[model samples]
Target chain A: MLWEKEMRVPNTAVVDGKTYATVLGMVRDDRFIPLELVYKPKPGDNVVGIVTNVRHAGYSIELNLPYDGFISSKFTRVSFQQGDLIYGRVKFVDEVGNADITDAKRLPAGKIVDVPASKVPRIIGKKSSMLNVIRDGTGCSIFVGNNGYIWIGGKGNLPLALKTINFIVANAHKHGLTDKVAEYLNEHGGDVKVPPREEEKPPEEKSGLSEPAEETPEPAKEPETAEPSEPSEGEPVSEKEEKDAGSSEEEKQNPIMHSKSAGAAEESGEVKKKGIDIEEM
Target chain B: MEKPELIKDGKRLDGRTPKDLRPVKIEAGVLKEAQGSALVEWGGNKVLAGVYGPRECIPKHGADPYKAKLKIRYTMAPFCSKGEHSRSGPNRRSIEISKVIREAFEPVVLSSQFPRSQIEVYIEVVQAEGGTRVASLTAAAVALADAGIPMSDMVSAIAVGKINGQLVVDLGKDEDNYGESDVPMAVTHRDKQIVLMQMDGLLTREELAQNIDEAIEASEKVYELQADALKKSYEKEERGKLKL
Candidate 1:
């Protein structure tokens, strides 16, 4: 499960055209249901954290990863206690995965259930389809965190809502999970009418299809002459020959790509993006 | 002790051919307290490896700002070996083994991903045979993967030796006791990069090269077992549709 061929993609096991199960769980629609996850924060991630300490300038929040998150007072409006639950989007994540929280707000004293962070997507469903079902049926306002700490609020069916979350976490790998979750909620919810899955259509058909098709083809068109890893099959005009002849120009560009501080920043950003594709694919 | 016949008719004492490897069984997530744990039973050797962290490193001064530190402790239990009970705790042999194991994994474990933290691996040899070092190494690789640490590739280790002028793999107790040479090695699964290699006794340059090639080939089988154990940790039917 390391790679499809000889290509080495860091952090990820499956690459190129092959799909392999990297985590322990059921595989449905080529998507793995992770039994547990080693949580890693990405920028703009909505995370639920418990404030571990109130520092001078910020609060150190435990987002359940190896790294602790920080919420600076400049970004947060309310002062938080050592144990307060904060829900916020990750403003930035450092090279070490330590996150900075912004636009922070305190969640009410509702129950917080921890699910495997990787399963959060299944709980939220595709385009919030399953989330809408839980919200309507149980009448609880649920906040699904990318870091796996789910906050359930509202005076609605608290027990039922928690049960639904657990059910979804367990059966996240099963096919047609959204429909099954709706059926399970309706059966036990009693008189609470859960909406049918038909109401929500796959969001990809509307806009996702066109946008990616346009964006992806652009990069593939100009196969970069750089990194001539794959030797062309009997092609007379290989990029390697051209690059050899234009060694002077290549040397000139090398210093520009390396010397500039902004160029270094861009290079690091590209590396981060490359390594972060471990589980998402 | 008098020298026992290490090999008979080109087969080792255990009746295995020179290229034959000892039976290895690997199981992942054996310990509840550890973030990830694995147990490897290779021939007569029983090695258990447990992994914890990417959490804050203890003795804060040692924390690396750029990557996580790997602290691997390879130890044997008091009653692990046959005959007289060995003293418990980290002896010189165990400490050296621990250092080599850490070095083998350092290149693969994507430590830069979890900077300023520590990843600890504890390898406990519950039963000892001749090739416990490689067994512990194989077990530790699976344990780290079970903990969800991002490793570039899995490592597989094995012992190659020469007994009575004949090359052998996965030396048993008798062969190790009277063998001319023993070479324990670990290699990355995909590329076969030698991460760890330690030799004892004497061998010709050609024999050493042959032993290394044999060790690499044998390690591929070990990697298969490690991968199987990691996958089985999550694929258990009982765990399918987990309750609660």
Candidate 2:
């Protein structure tokens, strides 16, 4: 019932009392499932890809999706060879999941980590919390693709970063994952600094219990406006209509009374003016 | 071969009652290279199903513009059966089984979600009993779900037949070989809509209809096993991560 108000999206289903995922994924809010089981490309995605083929006009980039991505020669400032690693942003996505990438640059010699595209958000964490811990603690410069490919470079601890990422992917569906990941990172000799998670919004919002409280006032107001419109439309009056009809009738009367009083005031003023004019005559 | 006792009293050759199904074990994500893979052991049948794509359709010409094409290959190994060595390759029987399996899955798989793509399912019968087609389909459905292919609902299958004049669910190889009639059926458990149904022998109209209901009823158990297997695979990985 809590997820019905907030987390219910395309890939989620409600069975009995619990929300179940229809796709092969952790029980995450459907909105956060930008990367589906198969990565469907969206515009403005920062992507890491392997350049599989370099044509005269463009490069065919493999982003781990079913369809390969194409980067036109005009979009890139420098030429890329086959097998070169490139990091870019998705510029366009067609009706199918094919992507046209832009702003691509060759990445340095480093390891490319592949994860399930759906788990990309977990690796990134809330507000990049996990990413910052991995980056700051291991001192690795990391570039993450929404398509589940991660590029790690610079002189940071790559193994630690990878282990932390793997751990995040494994337990992506668990609650309080950030703290557990922080503990794991610290235990593994990575000097990752974990920002205090307590500063974040409390557990009520995370558990989604607080959402209905925010939502209750919304439905209460809808019935009030709907009550007057129903009678005017000559539709059958239901129980809800009958319930709010009293307040709606009062609201209707107040507006009519204001108009009637204003009309009376104008008439009385005109009569007084006429009386004054006749007296003068 | 002499006619063996297919059923005695209320039990079949495998010592299962008329309503009992063979033990079904399923494991998901078994192959690293496949997008999704599953192994299903139903009775003596060992079926491995692997899924690839919603990727670009090969040969360009075979691609469907509006929906992803489903290519299914249901094959059995040469040494899968008991008697003589079976020949490997797409024989007429495997080809027919492949088509029916594909048709069974077509309505459930949300192929329209991916245009100009193809999802290939390879169901290899490592060992065969009587109900390899149903077992392969059971595994393929799991593999598709494990691969994250969008499906409206999980499809499950079972075989039912009249063995020794007694209606039984999930016929064994000997029972199927000697039974008067056999019906292999696949159904979407949520709606009980029969996606695949085949009859191999004669039956009364009432018996045919009743066997369909029996197969649909038996498929619910198969559906539960598939769901549990898919979840257990992930749960095992999660537990391993926690141990770390």
Candidate 3:
């Protein structure tokens, strides 16, 4: 049967004289099953957004959320055309869920897939260890958004990486998810190794949520390792993979590596305090 | 034209009873490029529906600032009909069906959710026995759902008609050519809200009410079949999961 409108049983909140139907545990209803997942972005969170609408002033980005977030004019210095993928930080998130972003860097060539929004934390895993395993195994540069959109970029093991990641997303509700993903990665990830991440120095800090991508660079990108993207072939990168590296000029600006080049322990503590790891909501 | 025998011993021309619907087979996710696609075979009718976009709206000016605009094309193949030799282009009948079908869907779709975008549904009648619109509407809803377009509910449809002075459900080609009346109807499967209703030929006021009521109830079966087709699409992915 088509679902009738749910009975609003008194649980609501009034913010600025506007009342919203807010249920506990992010439940659609206490009486009925949950049908939709609403993603809320906190400050310092990383999101991969697709540029949905563009104008001379700025752009509107779709973050797998219902409403599009705006990247205003001043931040438009880094030119982003419509349909470009932006690896941005959530700068200003309001009670009404509207967002204003800053330092919106673009993601290079990659395949993007969306999973159920609530399943996002499971993909990130505990302290991002599951994410590390997937990244290390496949030799793909991976970035996951709080909005449940995942971007994977690299060479050779793409299709297999996509299959394994989607599996984790699908079966996340089940327990022992990390172990299963690790096992799958170990068994099918092949013999290649990920090169260490290069922590190029950061530009002057701009705002509170400046450079979450850099602050939380994946463990796969280390400076000491010899070029993480290629383990087997010492050949030139494909045109597509090369386009993914951003303009060579911007490489000096170094968008994704933070000033804090210490190590993984620092990365784990910072992300945890930020309350990034997904929890059932 | 000879009025072919439509019912004998309370059986339809296809040897089914008046209340018996034609065998219908629906499959979802049939086309690769379309966001969602479905093919439905009801009786002798074959209808394929493909849904694309909620992407960008084209022609610039046609883009609605408040809601997604709908672009619908309901067409019949030149050789879809038997003996009569149907034409390839849009006719008065197809145009009317297209308009009503669009109106039927616009109410339930939450188009305002995707502003300045266009969602297009193309329904192609590959084989036409009768009740092409009903079959098309059924397939279109499945394709739209499979496309992950947000909707209030999926709609299912069927045709009710009078054949040989007896009320019948889902008329066959020969039965329709010889039948007295055809009433095509669709309802929101979740709310049972009547979305599309049209009558042709003639029916008593009492027969019209009764047939419309009966057809709505009979649509429950069609709704179940539609759900089964969508579920079957995901079932095929299990092997892909296990293989990994």
Best by lDDT: 2
- Per-model TM-score on C-alpha atoms: 0.75, 0.78, 0.67
Q: In angstroms, give how far residue A28 of model 3 lies from its true place.
A: 11
Model 1 C-alpha lDDT per residue in residues A1-281, reported as the tens digit of each score: 42244322212343244333333333212222334446667555678889999999999998877768999988777999988987887777776667898878898888777766656766776556777788887888887777878888897898888888877764443334565567787789623354433433221111111112232212232222222222111111111222222233224323322321110000012122222221211
Q: What does the lDDT come to for candidate 1?
A: 0.68
What number of backbone clashes does candidate 2 have, counting pairs of residues 3 or more apart or in separate chains?
A: 1
List candidate 3 stretches off by more than 4 Å: A1-46, A49-56, A59-70, A76-85, A89-100, A108-130, A146-149, A154-159, A166-180, A191-281, B83-89, B238-244
lDDT, candidate 1, at B31: 80
Among all windows of 10 consecutive residues in model 2 chain A, the one with the lowest summed lDDT is: A259-268
Instruction: Tell me how many clashing residue pairs each candidate has.
Output: 0, 1, 6
Which is the winner by TM-score between candidate 2 and candidate 3?
2
Write candidate 3's Cα lDDT for A1-281 as tens digits: 10123232222222233222221111211221111223445454567889988876788989865457879878657888888988776677654355677767888989887764445656665445556667777778787776667787877478777877778754543334554566576667543233132332111111122222232324223222222221111111111222222233123222211211111100012222122212210
Q: Which lDDT tens digits does candidate 2 get at residues A73-136?
A: 9878879999999888778877766899987889998889887766676666545566777787
Model 1 has a DockQ score of 0.28
For model 1, what is the error of residue A234's alpha carbon versus the real structure, in angstroms, after optimal superposition?
43
List of chain B TM-scores, one per candidate: 0.95, 0.94, 0.94
Each candidate's fnat, in order? 0.19, 0.29, 0.01
Please estimate how well model 2 matches the true structure, expressed as its whole-model Cα lDDT: 0.70
What clash pairs does model 1 have?
none
Candidate numbers, best DockQ first, in rank order: 1, 2, 3
Q: Quote the lDDT for A78 in model 2.
A: 76
lDDT of 3 by residue, B185-234 (tens): 99876457899998888999999988988898889889878867765554
